[model samples]
Target: MAHRDRISNLPEELLLKILSSLPAKDVAVTMVLSKRWKFLWTLVPRLEYDHSMYQDDVDGSSRFSRFVHSSLLLHEAPFLESLRLKLDHYSCAADIGVWVKTAVKRSVRELDIEINSPSLSTPVLLPWSLYSEGCKRLVTLKLSHTTLVDTSSSSPASFTSLKKLSLVHMKYPSQDLF
Candidate 1:
């Protein structure tokens, strides 16, 4: 009699569903468990990037950027169901814009971004224009510590599908925010 790997024998769909419950980073590391899981992480529809998680590394910022870029480039989800980013001083507005655009392009339905720019006298402005008409599938939006640039003219339909919205310590450039 020989021992069999029951978990490995599980269907790919079942494995993916289980993987989805873990953090994105943990899911990625599962690749080292065996060859069978090498591509499983890429199929996950939910992604989360937190700068604080890599603060101990010397090149954390750059590595974080590379990770995000590569993840977005290699990800093969039909649509991103959720994306959460907790960025700090290391990230720039341009990079944030690019990532947001990429997520929106992938039809991310839920977006949660928290920018901790404590040192900045001026708030980092979020490229809300990227979503003015792009995120038609967005259902929930949560933002913190970032200023929203108003493009009110086209914003009414932007978050049309949005059911839950949370804004914490968010600044609006204009008094009117749609």
Candidate 2:
């Protein structure tokens, strides 16, 4: 008798857990292992898109952008545990807002957005919706090398469940973020 394929027969939940531990790019690449894993990465709750990983390749930046767009569009997770984007290029301001909005709508618990578009004179403006109370479920938020345009006049606009917040090299419309 032939031995059963134990690894391939593992429960979907277990397989997803294993895949979640890897970087998002690697997780997506696992589709070639077998047909069973072709769409498994879409269920992962954590996603990290870092453009710096492709700095050596001439077309890496554009490819990275495409990967992010496709992954976000196809993700089937009910709620995202984390969404991280570290972009170092220009001409993607609009897409950034859409991505963040999607994550916010999914009730993401952790969000890390670091933009390094030094080629532009001004930093990209982060969507103001991020500061809205709808994102109360967010536990952690980190922003770097970006601009935040908060036009709200409310005092103490806060994230109710936020446990951590880090802002570095960021520009804010005002000093009322406290």
Q: Largest TM-score belongs to which candidate?
A: 1
In model 1, the runs with Cα more than 4 Å from the true position are 1-3, 56-61, 118-125, 128-130, 151-157, 174-178
Candidate 2 residue runs with Cα over 4 Å from true position: 1-5, 55-61, 117-122, 152-156, 173-178
After superposition on all C-alphas, the RMSD of every candidate to the true structure, in Å, is 3.6, 4.0
lDDT of each: 0.78, 0.80
lDDT by residue for model 1 over 1-178, one digit each (tens)?
9987789889988897788777676878888877888887898888888877764457445777777888889889899999898988887677777888899889899989888874444455555644567787999999888877654464454677889999998776655433
Instruction: Put down candidate 2 lDDT per residue, 1-178, tens digits, no spaces.
Output: 9977687799998988888777788889988878898888899998988877764347535777677889899999989999988887643777788889889888999999887774544446555657778787999999887776655557546688999999998766465543
